[model samples]
Target chain A: MRKKILIVDDVDINRDLLRAILEEDYTVVEADNGKKALEIIYSMKEELAAVLLDLIMPEMDGFQVLEELNRRREIIGRVPVLIISGEASVEVENKCLELGISDFIGKPFNNMVVKKRVRNVVNFFDSKNLLEEKVAEQTAILREANITLKAQAEQLKKRNQEIIDLLGTVVEYRNLESGEHIQRVKGYTKILAECFMREYPEYSLTQDKINIIVSASALHDIGKITIPDSILQKPGKLTKDEYEYMKSHTTKGCELLDAIKSEWDEEYKKVSYEIIRHHHERYDGRGYPDGLSGEAIPIPAQLVSVADVYDALVNERCYKDAYSPDEAFKMITEGQCGVFSPKLMECFRKVRGDFEGLAAR
Target chain B: MNLKECYASIGADYESVFLRMGSDSVICKFLFRYFDRNEYNGLEKAICEKRWKDAFIYAHNMKGFALNMSLTRLAGASSVLCEALRNGQPEDGVSGMLADVKSAYVITEKAVGNLERE
Candidate 1:
């Protein structure tokens, strides 16, 4: 259907003239006074394409109608208005334009200029409306995609946790140590690492890193799988050659880790590798497969080393009887089991009660 | 008299009006409709009653209606009267300006009559 056009003039002939010009291309609607024009404008707001308003009418003039339209922003913005008036003074034109009429046509109306201007205003508004609709649509689609991505990231984290637990089970079965050992070690590591983060801001450790450190501690003994059963489970001290073989477990554990093409996070695998290979490192280059000394050892490896030694001392191992928590704390603090970073020893001092608390559980 | 002579007699721009209207038939149709409403009488009544705002509106509408019909001489006369009554306060020489609009209206109406008879 042809778009509707409203011609408003109190004089019958003025409305008739515009109708004659526009009626061929549009569905012409006429209102002889301003009040009647507004009634038509409001009623046909959606269907009316343009309103040709006259400035002088009995009840409400064109300016009054324009002011009303201005208040109804949704209606005015969508529909174009072209003022047809003999009052072509700049002041009148400026006032109407400020009120948001799209264009002004002065009398005598040029048949072509009127047609061209009305068509121009109508086309411009249509394009603006279309662009706004497209932007709204795209925003909604992006919102949906963001929600889906958040849910996927949560699921991936959960799946990675399950895999870490499964690997710890394999180590428990092979090494024949109490499965509780790794769990307690994880608890102690997390407690000490949190305290370390507070007292040693130089490390810049976050809670996210602490979580990875504790979980990676579970696989610190994974290389015990490669040690001969007689050696790993011996109930007495080993000879010098056997001790050398036992030390190889750290490097072997990393080899086992490197053998598989894992699909989990690279950061997770990197933390696990550090824990497996260097948890035996000493502050004086006296411990471990690589003998990485001082702060040269990764912070993750240093943290798990303290957890591993404390858990071993308090838990009965194949080669030693369980010591009391106080005895284990003294051995670690006094450098009896291994030499650790002094900075770490300070954190361990603060978490002494925390470690004993987990041991009791 | 033919339509062109009739329009010329009133000192209106008949050729451009015909060209702008795009069709002689359309112009003639509006020409007859022009007499359908006479705001000049309303303007005169408003002045006599001292309804200044009403008088100004009547003159403003008269100017627009005359211009739309290509009666520039009438539109110009009415425009002068419109400005005098614009603020709705009585001004000096407004009656003389009103007289000028009346003469233009007379000539315009006479031309319409002649065209109707032709």
Candidate 2:
């Protein structure tokens, strides 16, 4: 590739002289003053590789032009500038260097020196372009790797979600719940989580987190698999020891998940285990094996806890009568039943009608 | 490396890229989300009971996560169990591999957790 050089000089003879020396090997562009040079530079962009600037030009001086070029360094990158001056001084030369001029050509210069200096800066321009080419190639490669990695991640996310769906179906079937119970709970949880997030946007819980909550909520009762079918599908209230055994389902669910921990993600692992282990926990510290109370229990568990109780109370079950929405709400919000956070209770009160609407769907 | 040094080495663009990559990396997200104290407790109980089928499932599941994280050795160990179970091999050498997997998970888990916190 032939690099195009732009020569900006007010003096016609000097411009002609420089162009005559450079034109054979290089494609030369001419500008009478700094302003004209800048116009060409802006329009030319990547094609113009170097500039032969005259220090004493009308309108915009070479130093002013240099400052402007420096300002646009990001777009221009490392283009070489060789200043052509008739009156040379050490201080002026030093100032040019400090201001990042590539080279200098003094007055009455040897024709060979002009050729050599132009060629030197042209070499600089070529090397810079080469380096930039390498960087662009590397960036392209990195971009391809990133895209591959992202696709792999997306595939895994889809597969994990499938596992969650399959597990939810399996557990619900084993527990003798309705086919749509787990699916409905998932839907309800999503709506509630979104509503909660909207009500508290300052927390910055992303939509991703909300989706996880919905997907993982389906597996809340997986520990019931570890319980005996007779106990799991029992039609009547259990004996004290049997209830104690059933209470161990939280730990049992955690154990079952642990068996698959090697395959699961830590976030899903935590949220899933908490949903299983602590969904039975009461906000007032009165429910379950651990009896973790209030915010002490993980928030995922609390969310599931409310969802679980509300659904269990309203939906027809093998051992219990389905309560009306009013009755269920009254029971959950009794002054001291030792269930649910007050703040969450307030949210439930606001959203129970919406919950019923979702359940009906 | 110290925080600033590691940050520098990764580039000023590191956080944006790291977070973008981490979210886009299933293994990283899985490690951060699923493998936790509760999982440890569950696996301990399952192993103590010698529930081989359950062990095989856990090991294989861990293998999936390890492979995704590019924790090759951990993935290899879990893979050993996964293959054993897939081929219906008895759980004879699983304990050794499980131990290797446990250590790897701990190290990666802590390192990743620190990065996330930072």
Candidate 1 Cα outliers beyond 4 Å, as residue runs: A8-12, A30-77, A131-139, A172-180, A192-210, A225-235, A259-262, A294-296, A310-361, B47-54, B84-99
* Cα displacement (Å) at residue A126, model 2: 2.8
lDDT by residue for model 1 (B1-118), tens: 7778878888888888877788766777777666656657888899889899999988888888778667989889988989889987978988898899989988887778677542
TM-score (C-alpha, index-matched) for candidate 2: 0.58
> Against the true two-chain complex, what DockQ does each candidate achieve?
0.67, 0.00
lDDT of 1 at A111: 85
lDDT of 2 by residue, A1-361 (tens): 7779899986554566677668877899999888998898888867877898877654787888888888988534667888976436798899888878888876535555688778987787788889989999999999999999999888877877877778788887785456577877777677667777777677566788878888999888888777887886788998998899888888887888777844656676677777888888888789886988877987677777777777888888777889987787788888333578776777777788888897667
lDDT of 1 by residue, A1-361 (tens): 7889999988777777778778878899999888888789888887988889988777888999999988899888888999999889999999999999999998878887788888888788778877878988999999999999989988887767766777789899875556898888899899989999999998999999899889888999898889998898888999999999999999999999888675787888899999999999988898988888998999999998999899989988878899999999999999998799999999999999999999999
Best by TM-score: 1
